[model samples]
Target: MAEELRLFAGVDAGASRTALVLGDATGRILSRVRGGPGILRPGRAGAVAERIAGLLKQALGASGPVASLEALVIGAAGAGREAERGALEEELRRRVESRAVLVTTDAAVALQSAFPEGPGIVLSAGTGSIAIGRNREGTVYRVGGWGRQFGDEGSAYSLARAGLAAVAKAEDGRGPKTLLTARMLEAAGKVSVEELIAWARLARPQRVAALAPVVCRAAAEDPVASLLVQAAAAELAHHVEALRERLSDFAIPVALSGGLLVKGSAVRDALVARLKAAEPPVNLVDRGVDPASGALALALGLRP
Candidate 1:
């Protein structure tokens, strides 16, 4: 008898959006869908799960009753830890019938996408930031997965925070002024700085991060903003270098993902330049494939 063919599903879920891709045993894409955020924030878990379930069904689109799904692999924003992973796994199990299901931190899947054998560094800097790397020996090292307030270094949130700092410095006359201040002011449409502060105090951290592009654009012409962008790129490089040292794998590839590194990206070029200038030039991959591909890769492995 011929061997049975299997189907796989992959999901890459972030704070701002989610992507799902279905692939056959041969790693060919069958269906793909993109939707709103998938992370279950403090009070939004139920809603997020609902959305994910909806997207899955919508993507499947009556593809002859998807019960044949062999395996599922998901990379989600908060799925790194046991608590969040457990919740997500249960939710997925409830929604679909699969032979096996795996839920991993978004960084894990991102790294997998970058390095199929799982030995390299991946920096995901969309609404937040995380640096994860696997050594040639299969050891993993992670840095800066803390949320926005605590860390998230070199993230959109970090850039936006830097923008706020620039705005403050400009207002206090303590540093170089920037067009970022005006752009931010325009974003808020606040009459005064005080109102801007008040508005931000009541806003979500991701909401703050939404303004990162404004800062990046301003950086093109504003010295302060430019400094911020360069600084962030340098910081990201530092994290990559640190992972390189810890893993002692100079040849390890580094992959960059996330919205900030994608369309209208301002720091991708600078980041690649800094990596190439490292002690031993780090190999940088900029294929820009969605992390969901990694999940699909994992899922396909689960089949017969």
Candidate 2:
């Protein structure tokens, strides 16, 4: 007789998208599914929970009914607070049939994905930015992640907003000319700055963040764009510096995650170079692992 297969499910819910992965007992992934935005705020827990549940079901269906998950782990953005995590946890409990379900902040899982055990730091800079570090004593420290309003300085949304601001400044003859003005006009599908401004007024963070690549591309040839990229890198390095201060007084490996850092781009290279040149220098991981995979590892008790 063949050995029975024990399955687990891992969910990585971020501000922009929610990803689900189905894995067997050995942590081998069987299926993956993606859905809409996650619960990044306490107020949207119910809706995000519903979306996650739907994605879970979709993954299960795609993987076939013969496989049943023994556990489900979810790492969600904005689930840092106990109340918000509890609400989502309760909702998952009511929706998923797994025997074990765990909930934590997305940053925690991102850290686990890179470090697995021991001490390390993980900086996630997608639509938003947050840094998390774990000490050898298992103490977790966090910096930034205040969302787009007050924090998220090194985030794609921040980069996009800065790019737009530069364009406005240039249009008013208050700032140096740059290629970003034309890029913004192209992205907004408008012929004039006034129309672009009108569209921008109604653009959400995701829509605005979509322009980060434009800024990055122009950075190679445009001085203003280059400065913005450099400034963004500096902001991200600050987050690492702040988190490093809270950790143990030792060299710890740092991992960069999220679309902005993970993707091959100029900003990533600049950020890495900045960290490498920092006083005492930061030990950055070559690449980041998937947070959903980290959730799977956690579900299988892979941690020390």
Candidate 3:
């Protein structure tokens, strides 16, 4: 009889999408699946769970016998809360016979991925924004995970909000004029600023966030848009500065990630420049590893 292969499953559940990857002990990917957003948000648990189950099945098909699985690691948005993490863990255990399950907030995996072996800061700007890091001596620092309504100061939502506001103010002659009015109008496909307001007011977080790229593209040719991008980058750097103060005693590498940074747009360059402006500048280190890989490392108990 052949021995049953023990596989590790890594899951990253976000507000917009959920990713699942099954891997061997040697970090070889066996199967990967993606599904609708996780049920971390309020009042969407049932639908989210159903979506996640479908994705899990797809991943399991390629992973072989789920009964022989050794460990599962899940990094999810809003999973930082103890109750939330506990609930998801219970659900997973009931669904499968995996020997162990580890659940953490997505930021945890991002941090681990950025600095698997040591101390480093990770700036993630997606639908929202957060800066997280751990020092060599085990001290941790964090900034800006307040969500879209309250914070998300350096996130895509922030950019969209600023762009819309600029156009609105310009239309009313209350702010400086800019080409962004035309650009935003084109991107939103609306007749006027009023229509744009209505369009974004009812749109999902990611939907509003989608305009960030458009904003960046216009910023390249428009000075007003450039100022908005610069401001967003500055805000992100401010968070890094706060972390720096908190970890004053430790030497740490700083990594910029997510759509804004990865895209290499003006916003990202401004963020880098602002960080360097600090009195004691941080070292910009490479976060070569992706979040999915970090989740895998966590599943296999190989994370540093």
Candidate 4:
């Protein structure tokens, strides 16, 4: 009889989506799967768990036989809190049995992706923003990632919120008449400013953050939008600076991740300039780093 394969999985549960990397005990990748947004909502943790479990099952196939994997590691935003992480871990375990389940913060895996072997900073500005890193002595440093309510500064959500505010101020003559008013209105797919307001009032964080690209695209022609993007850049830079100060390595690489930090975008460009102009400057890792791989590494005990 053939030996039952000892399987493992890792998940990156980000605001945009959840990705899983499936592998076996031999350190070979078996499959990669994706699902809808996996960010843990305040009242919707169970749904998220079900969605992730469905993907895991899809990757494993229906007849894979084993009731549980050897291990599963998940990196999810808002999972840093013991209560939240414990809840998510419990939920996953209930749906997909595993010998060992590990839950960690989204930023933790992101930092691992950027610098799997040593100290480096990863600045993530997706629907939310966060910076997490480590120093020479293995001490970790983190900034932001407090969620939208606690100020997801430099995030797509923040920029969109500010852009909406700018549109409101411009409409009332309380601020400059900027193209953001038109740009954001169009992006929201509303025919009128009133419709835009209605949509903004009831939109989810991801929907609101969708307008951030509109803000970014309009920044080239709108002074108000440009200022907002610039401010976001500064805030993101501040995050990196805070962590860099805590890191002992002077030449560590700095990785920019997420939608808002895409190459050549207004915010990314401004942030790169700001970091490059720092007193001692900074090093940037231009390649993309998949945090799911980092999560898998942790799952397989591939790194410390």
The lDDT values for all models are: 0.79, 0.85, 0.78, 0.84
Give the TM-scores of the predictions, in the order they appear: 0.89, 0.93, 0.91, 0.94
Best by lDDT: 2
Give stretches of model 1 more than 4 Å off: 1-5, 41-45
> What tens-digit string does per-residue lDDT give for candidate 3 at 56-124?
678887665465567878787766577777777777777756778777877778887778766788888
User: Backbone clashes in each candidate structure, one number apiece?
Assistant: 0, 0, 0, 0
Lowest summed-lDDT stretch of 10 residues in model 4? 1-10
lDDT of 1 by residue, 127-171 (tens): 888889998789998887777777788898899888887787788
Full ranking by lDDT: 2, 4, 1, 3
Candidate 3 accuracy as lDDT = 0.78
Pairs that collide, model 4: none
User: What residue runs in model 2 are displaced by over 4 Å at the alpha carbon?
Assistant: 1-5, 66-68, 302-304
Evaluated at residue 147, the lDDT of candidate 2 is: 82
* Candidate 2 structure, TM-score to reference: 0.93
lDDT of 1 at 11: 90
Q: Write the per-residue lDDT of candidate 2 for residues 1-304, one digit (tens) a residue.
A: 1323577888899877889888887778989999988855767777877887898889888776753568888999877788888888788787778778888989888888898998989999999899999988889999998888899998999999999999999999999988999988998788998888778779878888989989999999999999999999999999999888888634888888888886678789899899999988998776556898888888777321
Off by over 4 Å in 3: 1-4, 302-304
For model 2, what is the C-alpha lDDT against the true structure? 0.85
lDDT of 4 by residue, 1-304 (tens): 2333777788999887899988777657888999988887566668878988998989888436566788888899777678888788888888988888888988888777778776788889999999888876788888888889877899999999999998888888899898988777677778877789888889888999988989898989888988999999999999888778777666778988888998778899989999999878988878577888778877878322
